[model samples]
Target: MAETQRFHDRVALQLDDDGVAQLRLSRPDKMNAIDAGMFAGLVAAAEALQAMRGLHAVVLHGEGRAFCAGLDMASFGRMSEGGGVANGLNDLLERTHGLANQPQQVAWAWRELQVPVIAAVHGVAFGGGLQIALGADVRYLAADARMSVMEMHWGLVPDMAGIPLMRELLRSDVARELVFSARIVDAEEACRIGLGTRLCADPLAEALALARGVAGRNPDAVRGAKRLLNQAADGDAASLLMAESVEQAKLIGSANQREAVLAVMEKRAARFQD
Candidate 1:
């Protein structure tokens, strides 16, 4: 059996027996905006996911009209007052999750997860919201979705793991343009610029289908593939080749690998154990 957990009423997490996990941003009333509570919820949810057994794939999405509208206005107001916000800003500088602070961990945690993570984005994903989606291995956007690197509009820069994540997905020039102009990009342009992996009529549905397909594969092989792909983003050619060999060596004659081969030969589905 699977259970759903709520974090400060801002994030919801549910795991199915098939090893597919669904993580939803739940603050719909505020367009799922990131506030102090939302930040805490996101980190808590990511930490919980890290310990989940048999986890294979994850789908990240938002409830309500927009995926996320960046930071909450109240938080900005606090910054203007120069009191409450100062403490929060200082806290972001402290390392809480190995190379990332608490806020950065909200996004980087997905990148650190061993299994595949798919982001299903719709409505608008601005600033922090956009950064969160970029952290995922794949992004599925609805045709009508709107996204932007909007920190410039607020006289701020993206600091929540956005820079490193964008480097992995976009060309240097393209990233600079979007970041400089703070322009809103439609789904088609987002796909063309590499911000989105695919565009769909229903992003959540398509993302779930993709996640389920990934979950049905041999878990060890799937994890190895994700690890290799992640390494390819930053590793040298020789190192990547060595990593490929190492991963393949672990998978080639394993029981799950053998089951995969036999199932294909028998024209049946493979029953893989965790």
Candidate 2:
């Protein structure tokens, strides 16, 4: 294990030699609820990860029983007194982080990361927390985990980049109902509805194992695939087809690709440089 970096005392980031990073929301006593500090910490964590060279994969999880409960009561209390004011910020409509505010950045930053991010969810993921999970490329959820789009209960809406992320994973009606009703969903139902990628008895362990496998692969190829996939949804057929060719051409005869083929033929693990 490398030195664990603390962000605002709310998030812990540990990067291992295998090019995998574990980002834990560290406030377990409060179910890892998103408070003002947590909001800032998450953005900081994402920024730090994006800057880390040779980082192939990331596993995101909470330190305690739950992934995240939701926005903390103190934030709600503060909103009531200050009319949506946050950390001396202007308003929610303000773009604080290039097409995202601070709250949205907590979730959106993971989506913009170059490498794959896997969320290992347990206990409850509500509102903003669920958005954070949705930001990941894959989600491994515990059987007992419960999730909800719970902003309705607070007389608010899913403003933390939840709507766009949910639309990519869920049917329009299911997404609408979840947001409008704010009903609790079990892990089984969440997986069935495309909210969760898979179920695991020990979600964090499963996630770490999977991330290690991803990290063991050709790092450039993995990043290229992620880039193409992220652009697939909104890209035109002709553009995406050309993009695939362009990306493939760049990797087909590369050193990493040659090493990958040699390792497979020799029945050995591929040692990737990046």
Candidate 3:
């Protein structure tokens, strides 16, 4: 399906002229919880972003009082009937989307994007909700926002790749304590512990500003930097250096690159294509 202001009835995506996409979880009535439709919406948004040329960044935020409350209550009801979470999720062991299952993709999709995704977290980001926030390249959390590795309390692991994302951000000991205890962390402590990239009075506004700033840069360079950084943790020094060269080689002397240089000299904004 073509892009629209709203899709799947639960998510909205808007890419402005600045090349910054505003991706919102729109099911406010349910605190934007992850339901079957929400899952599809997230995946569809990510897929659309991947196809959108000249996109530089994304600002992901929730549309209601909370970012997301995690899986819908109905999913928990099904688990209470003595079966795994199989509603639209299928088998937990199946890897439906490369290295992740469909459920994991809801969060992993943001991380997998080549461009930067900044999550503007507010209210509460619980369980799978927190995982989705973590999927972003950076998180700007409101001062009063709350987050948790919430699945443990429900007799499940952080199955939405939250643990894996947390491993990248939090200390091993800290992650263990939070996952095991299912403790909720406020924005202040979350920033101190590295779960939040930044804390502010208004996260969505800050995130959008940051995204627009990034969008103002040469998009090719911005994408190259993100692609390189995404592999830094896993790739060896030699491989990463080569990867950096490969990315730079593609960006050097491109039209946007030349425009960036001329724009600096002329003290004007560089025009980029979409």
Candidate 4:
């Protein structure tokens, strides 16, 4: 498998031989803060992921002292000059995407992928950055990672779809407390609060390792498991049961799935679909 690199100059996209794609937020000079370029790059990266064949997993991380310092100061400045913060996002929402819905889709698209997405978070993942991380199927945070629900401090609620994502992860009261308080919490506290999967010594390396492991498994089973799990996370009781049936129905007679069972029986590696 030849690795392909997609360079947008602001976001770095790389796909490895084992089918794990890595997307790095590259505007380190400003702590990789969200700006027009970064947002465009993120959308392009998501589009690339959707088009690529044989994608097994993805790892999203930032290149800087912080995962991201949240929205760029320029955005805030513009918001101040205009109506307000809500007005700023409202403009972005109206102009920046397909019918898929831009702001929510930016993070939600990761969840929409057929494969698993693991976010490797470090330093400060605040506001929008934290919301983006929450979109991933799994998050590996550095033990010293600092995170906050920072929108309230700016006199805004999290409108980048953080509420829905966080709702599934935290209890209602706890989620409310975190969002309202806007206090930064360390990785250990994040884990305790159900915001992170593991407190890694080195999050990026750990995320990649996990991606490789998933890639090496039966891709069909792995993808099916992701579908089932994702549905279970947000699905109602009836849909949860139907989700399993629906996913299993797709796998039952599929060539790759059959090969998966055969390969296991023959003690060999399965050759899967592209």
RMSD, each candidate, Å? 18.0, 17.9, 17.8, 17.6
Colliding residue pairs in candidate 2: none
- lDDT per residue, candidate 2, 4-76, as tens digits? 9999999999999999999999999999998878998999999999999879999999889899998886665
Worst 10 residues of 3 by lDDT: 236-245
Angstrom error of the Cα, residue 106, model 1: value is: 0.7
TM-score (C-alpha, index-matched) for candidate 3: 0.83
Candidate 1 wrongly placed segments (more than 4 Å): 84-89, 234-274
Q: Which tens-of-lDDT digit does each residue in 14-65 have in candidate 4?
A: 8888899998888899988887677667778888898999899999999978
Highest TM-score: which candidate? Answer: 2
Residue range 80-153, candidate 1, lDDT tens digits: 34333322643444566776776677887888899999999999999889988988999999987899998655
Report the CA-based lDDT of candidate 1 relative to the real structure: 0.79
- Candidate 2, position 51, lDDT: 98
Instruction: Give the C-alpha miss distance for residue 88 in model 2, angstroms.
Output: 4.4
Q: Estimate each model's TM-score.
A: 0.82, 0.83, 0.83, 0.79
Candidate 4 ranges with C-alpha deviation above 4 Å? 1-8, 83-100, 235-274
| CA shift of 206, model 2, Å | 0.9
Q: Rank the candidates by lDDT, best first.
A: 2, 1, 3, 4
Count clashing residue pairs per candidate: 0, 0, 0, 0
Question: Candidate 2 or 3, higher TM-score?
Answer: 2
TM-score of candidate 2 relative to the true fold: 0.83
